[model samples]
Target: MLDIAKLAGKIPGISHHFQQEMTASSQRLELAKTILQQAQNQQEALIERYQTWRDRLIFSAAMPVEPLDTRITIVPPPHRHSVFATDGSQIAPSHHEIAYCYLINVGRVMLHYGQNLHPLLDSLPEVYYRPEDLYVSRQWGIRTEEWLGYRRSVLEAQCLADMACGWVNPPGAHHEPNLAMVDGSLVYWFLDGLAHDARDLILVPIQEAWEQLKAARIPLMGYLSASRSVEGVNFLRLHNCTFDTPNCIMNCVDVEEQQIPCKVIEPLRDTTLWGENLQPGQRGPLWQSSARILELYDEAQRIYFCYVNVGTEIARIEVPGWVAEDQDLFNQGLGIMLAQVNKGFGYPVALAESHNQAVIRGGDRIRFFALLEQQMIRAGLQNVGTSYKEARKRGSIA
Candidate 1:
């Protein structure tokens, strides 16, 4: 076997790598500082340009400016509430494995805070081996990793939504705000590249999930930590000098002296701006996602997001436009999310717990294959041999 001691000796190299990244991050901070300074007093101008050139702007750009204070203290959690979080994991089909199949495992955690703090955990696994379930993209002639990813996304949403739909009041008539959270963007970020029909395969289920949650009177949110999206920066970019010119390239290239408008705010992600401004329990103003896929969704399901300072990191939290438009639901959702963050030490405990439950470990995979092999032997069927490379790895002495 390889010497783990030798691997431990590489700690210095890892530390060096960490230092290198921190140095680059410091450089980025200087650039971001310059951008924030240049954005001063220009919010209204940027908002105007956004209204005029929104459709013409890049799909990845931000919408109109929603003015918000740079910093605010964390809001205290509601005394009584229930928070539900779900996360899913998958074992992609492998040709070398005996079974031509895949599995998606979803984990859920429900946390209650009030008279007593407690948590309930559950995990569900679904296996797919049927030809139709194993492969997608019939029109395109082959199932790709992209299709599999999309399937997993749909399953994840469905699992959480189903759970939310079944939630009920606590014992003895105690009532509390109920909220559900998922671990990604509310928008299907990959749909921009898909045809309408193909996109619908994934979008329909997600829309149904939203409707189910809404009908159950539960607010659903998608939470993302370490977000680097440029929604805020792109909004400022709309205020570029080329926005109104007939022949302008929208890149400020035609200016006589190369006087690039919005130069200071160029290439910075919205997280940096929010990170500099928001305090724990505080969030940036909500803005609609500018992703091209939003056009495919109805207004009720269109995605909206805001950046929340979770004490440890600036996280982007997304919800449907309908949720954002509801003043009461929106505030309650925010409160529950922040409360979970506080309880989890800068992250949502329920999501973290669910992820832990859903992960498939190496030993588990080995046991799964062993079980499959045993079943084949009992049925008097020849076992599908593993690839030569895999066999060698299993039999090798060193």
Candidate 2:
């Protein structure tokens, strides 16, 4: 009609442009519907993948570590003397600022003390980055990772040193503990970590400790916490051994069977506690026997490790054989593993657990002493003192 023509004519290309826009809009609407459908499909696929991962992790045991039964024999403590145990845990932010308290008995049974410090890193002074410390924060257009590296080393070394002292005496023992079972190895951190002037300082004290240990002839040994993970599997595989079956369970089998002073895996898992991770599994912290064999999932199987108290300080910490040349790596690795195991398999407590939470079983305190004797022999340390039978004969250390 004339009215429609006139309206179109009044606008410059308006009527024609509006018509084109409406058609384009219709096409866009159809395209949007297709895109939405595709997105929904992708979303469903992702959800399925996640559900599969969670299902695999929840329903399977994936990794099973070796057994630990009779791997350590605790020598029962004599009735005449009191039994003592000690262990410690560090407080950090990852644990929401709680200090972990770890313990082991005079019998050398490795156990966790559930007591902890509140507000973990809360006690530390707010660390300030001093001007002097920032000398290498960065250089013109260059990346400087020095602070992170330096700090990491400092922290690690300090922790190892702290562990050494923590084991030296349990808090408030008034005098030396009848025996202190520490985590990992018993070789005190005398010879570890030194640079330039610090080297001499570290060595001097270490030498003094060595001499003291030598004089006292006290047994210092490292404990290889049982794990089914990479390092543990390799360590045992290196020696070509497994849990000595059936008969060896009640007595100390020859660690000399492998003929090395190294920590051995105690068979702590069996067919019942272990299962394969089918594709429907997710990964977890459980120790695995294979390298490519990532733990589809892991169960924290807390086990009771024994302390063989031969009724004397002369005992074993090193498995009485050739230790790793990489001392730093070995020490750090072992400590972390022990802590993880504690977080997992150790006894569960809901309340504030006491440090001396010990339930004596059998006369097995001697098993701790026996393990100590074996450790001493493995370390190739020649004994010189009056034996425990003779220590009471001499009336020296109780």
Candidate 1's residue-wise lDDT over 1-398, tens digit each? 68889999998999999899777766766766665566556766666655666665443555533564444344565788888778888777888677777778788887787758667787888878787776657665446555777887888788887776666433455357878899878777788777767888889988998888887768888899888788767665544445454223554445654366544444557787678877667887777777776888887888888888888898998988778888778878888888888778888888889899888888877877778778888888874657777777677564
- Alpha carbon lDDT at 127, candidate 1: 77
Give lDDT tens digits, candidate 2, residues 1-398.
Answer: 26887787778788789898777655644443343234334443433343344332212221222222112222222222111122222211111111111112211122223223121110111122343333333432212232333332233223333333444445663222122223343322322332434334333443344333223322222343332222222222212222232123232244453452222222222210111211111111222222221221112211112122222211112321111222332233233323323333442111012122222233433343445457667777675233455345445553
What is the alpha-carbon lDDT of model 1 when measured against the actual structure?
Answer: 0.74
| Model 1: ten consecutive residues of lowest lDDT | 239-248
Off by over 4 Å in 2: 1-74, 82-177, 185-207, 221-398
lDDT of each: 0.74, 0.29
lDDT of 2 at 219: 28
Candidate 2 C-alpha error for residue 373, in Å? 51
Off by over 4 Å in 1: 1-45, 70-74, 115-118, 141-144, 169-174, 246-260, 395-397
Candidate 2 vs. truth: CA RMSD? 28.5
